[model samples]
Target: MTRTTPARPVSVEAVFPELAAHRSRTTRLHPRPGRPGMRDSHVGGPMLWPADEPWPVCQEPHRPETEGYAPDEIRSARAAGTWPASRSWPGGGTPGEGGPVPFMGLAQFFRRDIPGLPAGPDRADLLQLFRCPLTHGSYLERRYILRWRRAAETEDADDFLATPPQLPLLRWEDELPEPCVLHPEQVVTYPWAEDDTLPAALIARIDAWEDAQASRHGREAPSYQSDLSIPPGWRVGGFPSWASTGPLTVDCVSCATPLRLLLTAGSEEMDADSHSWVPLEDRDPSPHANPTRLRFGRDRDLHVFTCPADPGHPPRWLLA
Candidate 1:
């Protein structure tokens, strides 16, 4: 289903004209419960893999979690209808039948599909992501195996692997992305003291605008730079919607260069009972028609980072 962005009380641009320069681009991948095609741009969507190529695998052994079951046990429990909680993991379990599919998509990004990204080798824009499902710690953070392929290489783009390989997964499934249809929106981002180190004068001006908004609205709204009001799901731009460790900035290990925000894979699309940004027409508000069914760890947001100087450099993952 197409996503509906939240509505704002008033345009920030109307308040402070100078802040308009600070805007950035962000697209929310609104992935509802639907069948995405092999060639579609989506999370958990079918991959454009070659007919003869081997499906990727992760070899890490699964250890039992104190409260959760192992990879195999989880699958079995799901099949028998004994699993706890209303839903488990993203995309709400394999296809229509709620059993373990054995693998999860960690992260996904496209060089050509996205508007502004540094070029890579072969002059062929690539579509990259990861495959992993096993957990490593008490939080059950799943690891990942990175995969990158030229978007131009697959011409026919037919034939898809029926089920994901249940083999061992790698050590870092950084960000979990669901199959989603992107609703690209271009809007300016608010400058904050944390990520953007603005001069004292600019910072004061931002504070003043926020104060005015709070006074006008009769309550404290989210700060200008904090959680810049974007729709839920996997988004590419605006500030990240932080839950756990708040905001963090990491530098690339290979070159020590500061990384740019690549993607924010969120669990749920909108906050519970939050009518803000829920679309003007959505009277039902609880869940969309065909829900995406994907969620992050404990309602956390998984952020993927990459170096702008070299896209091939090892990217970093941060939980916010």
Candidate 2:
């Protein structure tokens, strides 16, 4: 519940109140390597599900029905806080080894912790996102969604048996996410892409402000718009630094309301030169690598966008 500090630290509405309407907010799930338990905001952390609830499965099909199985070597390695020495990957295989595989916990959010979340699936308190491990047709991975009551609501949360399915994995072989505590910092952000742009009048005003700052003295004055915080590493709110593709916009198909950035999935703990994103007080002195071996996609990022006006609206994912 700490106050959000922007990277460059500027107030958006303060300079131009007109631009307020176009302003958007995001929560960076700053994931890292740690031993986060079931009741924590973390990526790849332990799930707080009902012990008796049947684990999820993927019935989705794949290219060919070629099937073979690798034992629990990788799982054992992950449990031991390390990666397997070797893996048996599918050059081309069926949807699964045989039966349905369980989904792995990707992200968890507490309703009480985040203030702006719309009414979502798990009408209770906890929002858990599970990704099926099987690779479907043409690398299509299936996802299992669970919106459930908070772990605190259940008395036997710690005693529950959470199962992660054994399915085929590719690049994420070494990318086993460790449980890390979330240090939520709420920062203001602007749409960096033309598709997610402010109104023309607002853009003009921002241009004028940039011009004024340009005329101001000293090298510290903002020259480029990016001089501010396009934070690297794992963060919640703020503009995303696009790589493969630029900033994208996915409107709520049902309501047509512009979706907002809900998550930024990255492999590393910190991107180079994003020293500002690091919290003032952090456990690790060397912020370069996360002790957790999780990578979003090798070194790429996965951006998940959700509806701003309606939480019931389906979300969209963009790999940038």
Candidate 3:
């Protein structure tokens, strides 16, 4: 089913014309549980991978594969509509003792399905993402691997890998995302209130306006931070919310070029208080809001940024 975002109650640009200068277009990936084929753009769905290519594996140190379910086991539990929340790993060992663990196929996006996608490296037309199911780095950030491919060329290969390798054990089962198809809808958005792009004077004015509105309504008013600016959910190419980390410079470590938002795997499509951003079709009571069931950094949204100047540069991820 197609997903459509309801119109904002008030046109933000009408209230604060300055926002128009910072307006950005983002494609909200309304992901819902389904069996998406390899050719489709989706989250946690089967990827169109060529047999010749080796599936990505995380060589990063992990706690020995002691006490976690295998990929097939997780899939079985999900299919049976039961979650083994308390399931323990089969073995016992310390962290950083495990060998290579296969990366999970996280997402796939076809150039034809998404608008405003950066040109793929080597003029490729498909973008695939894989993630280590465990945390990494000083921040305990989930590691990601990106692959670009020419869809036509890959699909025309003699044979395709039937299934990518899966992790032998998954200690962080909640990070596993349920396969879901994408219903991409482009929407206009603004930067977070704390973004440096906005002048201090303008921010003060906006704050005063909000206060006046709240006093008049005798309750908290519609907020620019939550209601007018940066939308929640899995999306592409929009501004990131600085509400958490207060906007750190996401520059390319190799070329020093400013990076752009490539994708977001948010925990929720819409929160209970974000009813305005809810799609009209999803207003009826349902659990579609968190269909992907992807959890990251204490349920914080994961944002991936890629260097626009050079697609080959390693992508960076932040949890906000």
Candidate 4:
């Protein structure tokens, strides 16, 4: 036998006042798009507040006052030898004798840029921005200030055998280099070898094979082949012929899967996003270098999106 449960009584005070009053308040209080709540006030529209209402006052932080200098003042200072300039130390002197002397104070160099006059130079100006064409590595030039060996002429040569320290003078320039057409993300593999191991035996075999094939054919072997009999994604062009049989294997950083090798013949035009380049025909031997074999792997990161109806879906409420 099953037991029956009694129903609980409902209280009038527990009911919502809006529903109990029988007065239906329309959600559309304002005339606007969709379900009206608050309309966005765009510029050129009529003001919401009264015309006499005081305008919202913004309290912004006060900037420090700056003094204006005339062009003649700057020119006169430079003409009178008051302007500061970096000068090299004079030769033939004791250590730290003619090292670095303060040429001018900071106050003199920190001048405002005048319209007609030449712009005042800043002390911390950069000279250049050097970038590698291949790997895009940045390099800076450092000055090695060597001191004269005082004990070289004497009996003891190692007396003055101190390591000379280098001074790093950061060089930067206003002009920027052309933006890199191919980003590192677009390229599959870095051109440089991870290790210094050279394939000596492989190189010898490749040389011998190319010579025998060329001599037998009476001309250079076809650099490119369009046959579909080759492996998937393998194309013949600038890639070394021995590369197909080479034992080198590149694993993907994400999935650790071996990538399909594709040899692009020439510098191809890339997409707008700079993600990939369009494949072009086989490049000429004289102009084009051997194509680099790049490894491909899958990107393992998962992309998540929000469910529209269920706002509190999943472990947390995230829109993305």
Number of clashes found in candidate 4:
7
Q: Identify the candidate with maximal lDDT.
A: 3
Per residue, candidate 4 scores C-alpha lDDT tens digits across 1-93 of: 111111112221132222233221111001111111101111111112223323222122211112222323433443464632322323321
Instruction: Give the per-residue lDDT of model 1 (tens digit) for 1-320.
Output: 34456545557666666656766666655555445665655666666667666766544555432232244444355346565232233432222222233456533456655555335544445555564555544566555544556766664556556555552322222222335554444343554444344456766776887787678775446545433434455667555654466456679899989887777767666664234556544567665522444455676666777777787888777766
Model 3 misses residue 73 by how many Å? 4.5
Runs of candidate 4 exceeding 4 Å displacement: 1-176, 183-200, 222-278, 281-320
Mark the regions of model 1 whose C-alpha exceeds 4 Å error after superposition. 1-7, 65-103, 106-121, 156-160, 167-180, 191-201, 204-212, 219-231, 272-274, 280-283
- Cand. 2 TM to true fold: 0.70
| Candidate 3, pairs of clashing residues | 62-96, 63-95, 66-91, 67-89, 68-89
Q: Please give the TM-score that candidate 4 achieves against the real structure.
A: 0.17
lDDT of 3 at 165: 79
Of the two candidates 3 and 4, the one with more favorable lDDT, higher being better, is 3
By lDDT: ranked, best first: 3, 2, 1, 4
lDDT of 2 by residue, 223-295 (tens): 2244443455555545565756665666888888877666676656553444445555554537435534555
Q: Itemize residue pairs with steric clashes in candidate 2.
A: 26-237, 27-236, 28-235, 28-236, 28-237, 122-147, 267-295
